[model samples]
Target: MTALTLAAAQTIAIAGDVPANIQRHLAFMQAAAEHGVQLLVFPELSLTGYEPTLAAGLAIAPQDALLAPLRDRARELRLTAVVGMPIRVAPQTGVLIGALVLGADGSLAVYTKQHLHPGEDAAFIAGQGGAALEYGDNRIALAVCADFSHASHPRQAAEAGANVYAAGVLISEGGYATDSALLQGYAAEHRLLVLMANHGGPSGGWACAGRSAIWAADGGLLAAAPGIGDVLVIARHDGGQWAGHVVVL
Candidate 1:
């Protein structure tokens, strides 16, 4: 089988700045493509930080022209990227935490957060999640910040024939221990390769704990960022083995 490269883009978002964040995302995409990464995942609300109050005003349709640059870059680099944003689907009154998938083939898909954390209901509503992403022989299930907290979420993904589980999250230091443990447990229980992308700095008044990481099917730690900053945690599956590395950008 051919090798597959995956990466977690641990980025620091400029609060409520979509244009700046897009440039940052572009930079990460370029770096990932240089490393031959086929799939890259970024933190929840990466395009607009984790500020819920700003989400409503910032929400746009999935096909908004604002994302054209990102889409073009993905097609040019032949890299598939899952980027987080605030989006409102037609007839949906409330904003949803969206993971927008930009396929290498210039296709677009959306994955909304089905589960809402406690305080989130004030700013957003739970949404019907999107479909898993299929690349080569791998099927990937996507999760926004709070979705992975529920065991049923990952279980359903595995039952649906997903071999890779990727989550875009904004985890704070206080909740890091519990959250990371849950993600790792899911990996071991489901025997699915897991990848987590987290914010590299504070956002939405929360001090984020940026230790983005990846684990093999057995829950073995493959690669992780030491702390916080703009970096990429990459895992490569080749020759029937999984290996990892980090790129500080």
Candidate 2:
């Protein structure tokens, strides 16, 4: 079996600054590549920051010119990266919260957020069904910010034979404690690897909890960020259990 090393990155996002965000992402990507990480995950809306009201204007289509360089970075580094961005599905109707997966070979897989927060419903459309992709020896199930709040999301992924449940979230300051417990419970119930990447610091007038975390199948906290600044957390699944610590570099 091919071993997979997972890296969950928490970044301080600059609101509406796509270029700066991309630069930060590239820097982390380079660092992860140098550390021999196979899969790297970032927080939801990492590219454009989580501004629900402004998402309509900032949303990018899948084929937008801005993503070309990001795609190139993934290919050049030979790393699979899950980057969150606002997606414009239609011209003016609605947008979607999406995580665009760029493979080392330049292929792309898009996972739209299945569950939208109540506040976000007015701005974005929710996706239907579940999706999974193969990465090394693991079959990864993707989740957006609010998807992990629903028991059915992780349950369905477990039922679908997913060994890894990955979530990209923009966790606000108020929601940290609740979300952490929810994630722990989800991991325990499904007996699957739970990896989460969350935005850190304040952006677009909102402050996010920087507690990006990874849990083992038994609900053990394998790695967690210190609720401040940018963090790169690495966790290893050894003998069907998650082990290792958070690396802030």
Candidate 3:
């Protein structure tokens, strides 16, 4: 079987600053690429912070120029990057919280959040269905912040034959305890390796709890971030078991 290396990156997002955030994303992408990572994931709303008020103004199209650098980088490194942002649903419509996957060969695929949190209804529209990005022997499913909270969200991915469940979130320190428990249960029940990319600092006025992490297929905690700064958590399956670790930037 072909081995896959996955990375979940946490960043301190500056609200409404697409250029700054994209630059920071590039830095993280570069670091992950250097680590020989094949798939890199970032936190929800990573390219435009978690500022719902500014989402419409900052919402980008799938082929926006702001993403060119990352595409070039992905192509250069022969990797896939799942970067988060608020995407314009359509002309004169609304925005959706989406993870846009940039492939090594300049292809793009998007996975929008199928579920929205209570307060998110005001500024975001819920997406439909689930998507799994295929690579090698892995089918990695994507999830946004509130999507992981709903049992049905990951179940759809599991039922679709996903072996990796990766999520991007903004979890407050107080909520981490509850959120991590859910992720653990997900790993155990689905029998899929779980990965999370959480914000490092304040975003949308919430104090983010970094704690980026990787869990084994059997629900074992493999590696976790220190709840601050820029951190990348990686996971890989060896012949016998899944091994994971963190790389601080």
TM-scores for candidates 1 onward, in order: 0.98, 0.94, 0.97
The sequence of per-residue lDDT tens digits that candidate 1 reaches over residues 30-95 is: 999999999999999999999998999999999999999999999999999999999999756889
Per-residue lDDT of 155-191 in model 3, one digit per residue for the tens? Answer: 8888998989999998998899999999989999998
Best by lDDT: 1
lDDT of 1: 0.95
Clashing residue pairs in candidate 3 (N, C-alpha, C atoms within 3 angstroms): none
Q: Between candidates 2 and 3, which one is better according to TM-score?
A: 3
Q: How much is the lDDT of residue 57 in candidate 2? A: 84
Q: Is candidate 2 or candidate 3 better by lDDT?
A: 3
Error of model 2, residue 22, in angstroms: 0.4
Root-mean-square deviation (CA) per prediction: 1.0, 1.6, 1.1
Each model's total of backbone clashes: 0, 0, 0
Point out the higher-scoring one by lDDT: 1 or 3.
Answer: 1
Query: How do the residues 116-203 of candidate 2 rate in per-residue lDDT, one tens digit apiece?
Result: 8887788888876346878667888999889988899999899988888989898888888899899888889888889999987786
